[model samples]
Target: MMTRVVVIGAGPAGLVAAIRLAEGGARVALLNKGTGGLQLGQGTLDILGYGPDRVERPLDALAGFAEAHPGHPYGVLPADLVARSANYLRDLVGPALLVGDAASNLQLPTAVGAVRPTALASPSMTAGACVDGARFVIVGLRQLKDFYPELVVGNLVRTDLPGGGRLQARAAMLDLPAREGEIDSTGLTYARALDDPAYRKRFAQAVKAVVEPGETVGLPAVLGLDDHNAWSEVAEAIGAPVFEIPLPPPSVPGMRLNRALTARAKAAGVRVVPGSKVTGFRASGGAVDSVQLATAGGDRDFVADAFVLATGGFESGALTADSYHNVHESVFDLPLRRPEGHLVHGDYWGDPQPLFTIGVEVDEQMLVRHPGGDPVYTNLYAAGGILAGATRWQEKSGEGIAVASAVRAADSILAAAATATDQGAAS
Candidate 1:
């Protein structure tokens, strides 16, 4: 008998699981509400501790773990698989990896002047570069605009990068003015700028003019570069090495990855459904049998041998728990572990000490746990950012954790199915 697995959501976590499960000889179907939340990100996998100190290059650290744990769900595969995945990602976006030593000093150009200091690899390197009196030159486009330079300056001030002194930053707006009463979209806007090589070159020249000689310029992640090729030219022409800063609220990288993965998953024979919300689950004894999905056509039942929940946190609209101390799984009514307070602290900014607290409890095998600390579902598994007890943001281990957890979950599910098949054959 063929084993069918239903996966919800198309974020990094969900996509990774779907691919791995398919490779494991399981029939996988992925469902989501369009795109998901990945596009909003900057697309850089933040591996915080890869250096000798284990305090930076976090992705490197995770890579080491993957290397050690051969056949583990999150472990690194053969060189070919790694190369293929990296190439696929690079083709989809600008670059797969942003390499830089943590201890090396970076020269940052701000509004006032240039500042040189030891820079750490982060999605947003501008803030950290502001230390040692780095001058920041913020470039803003006229029409395709989203980031605010003033806000970044404020954050730099809060961090006290410049010897606890004030930051020197300047803003240059690249006016891509729009027509009156016209709606501007991300694709169209990007197309308008990227279609013309001369336009992009002129824009780069304008940006270069604003910066002093030998000063590194900080720009938004959206540089209007070619989807397939542009990073090298853009970096060289701009003179100063450009650092792409991540935008808050809605991340562009996260969104792009979601779309790319969704398309790839569908093309690979996986049924990709969106806007179909999972209302509840049908369970008997200790196992889930089916899921109730609500779509425009009305409610329908999707039965599968196994299930993978990747709805994500509150942002992705997966697990919804109210202030009354009551939590709803949203789809299967799966039991969740909730903290008393919504957030550990009042302020939502910065690392906030312990950071956010919203995840499910899973055992070593990646099986969701019950209130009594026992596996709730034999064939059910959970992974990615939704897994409890790990903070992806503060820990700077989002991509690593998601990939690792998904691998583990898929392996466990496959192992369980194999065991069940063997038992039935014996019986």
Candidate 2:
């Protein structure tokens, strides 16, 4: 019989775990509360960004990360797998995702114009990476509320590209299309408009007017939602390389990635149950017997041979705190890595906050463990932000930790199931 595996949380880690488990012949169910963290993310996969200072060589930094952050998720797993998983994700997402290699980092400009480093980025996000002697003309939609061309240009002007190149940035805006009032004029609305060839052509012309030859044109990430060819058409029309700078919240690129992964997961035979909030689980004898979630009808329980908890930390509500300041793991109420500060903190720019680093402690096999280093459940594993160590946002290793741990946990589950089958056969 195929192993029945349940992966909780629909973020990159959960999705990846479910997909891999299903592909490996396990019956997998992926559950999510809301859309997960994709929409709120910056859209690019940042394996590791800064290590005390900006990191030019990500793979090299990863080698030392285990030493500096001995309790980090990357530390528990082999360094080579962590490195390989980055490449694995780029391949898994397909070439269209346009990820860079682990050997180096991609330096892209943020919405505010400050240069940031990431290991993997979308094609549109990496378009203007040629910072050395690079000049930019940024375009914005007049009606879009969040994106500001002036802010992006101002921040970019102060930034010199990664490769010792001088930077020049200019700002421009396009008047809303005459029919723009018909829609809400949001980033999603703007992307749909650009999906139409006629509208895209006109918008391209507006951006082209501000850009000179050989200079890349940067625009908000609203090029197109489902239309992969939209960015190319605009670039072809403008006669220059066109790139997208991400917006603050509800990021378009991030949504696109989630959609892509979701589609692929569905195709791979993974059962995706969205909007299903897992409220609790039943455990016995150091193993999770079943998971319970609230349904429209009422609460439902699911039994599985193995479980992977990719439930995110504070942001996704997988981990919570009360007024008393005690942080609790929402699902199994598993022991946390650190008890006192379920959500403690330091100054934003000062030392790393103790709260973010506190999470479920896992063994090398990725199995969630008791505080005393005993496995809470031999068949229950945890990954992503819920797993302990490393300030992900500050270190910029969010995607790296999520994908690597998920993949590793899935592998361990499959191996354990196979061993069980062998033992049963001998009996």
- Considering every candidate listed, which one attains the maximal TM-score? 2
TM-score of each: 0.72, 0.95
Clashes of each: 38, 0
Tens digits of per-residue lDDT for model 1, 76-109: 2322333333333334333333324332333333
Per-residue accuracy of model 2 over 235-279 as CA lDDT, tens digit each: 998999889988887988888888888988899899888887898
Reference-based TM-score, model 2: 0.95
For model 2, where is the 10-residue window of minimal lDDT?
176-185
Candidate 1, residue 104: the lDDT equals: 34
Question: Model 1's lDDT to the true fold?
Answer: 0.57
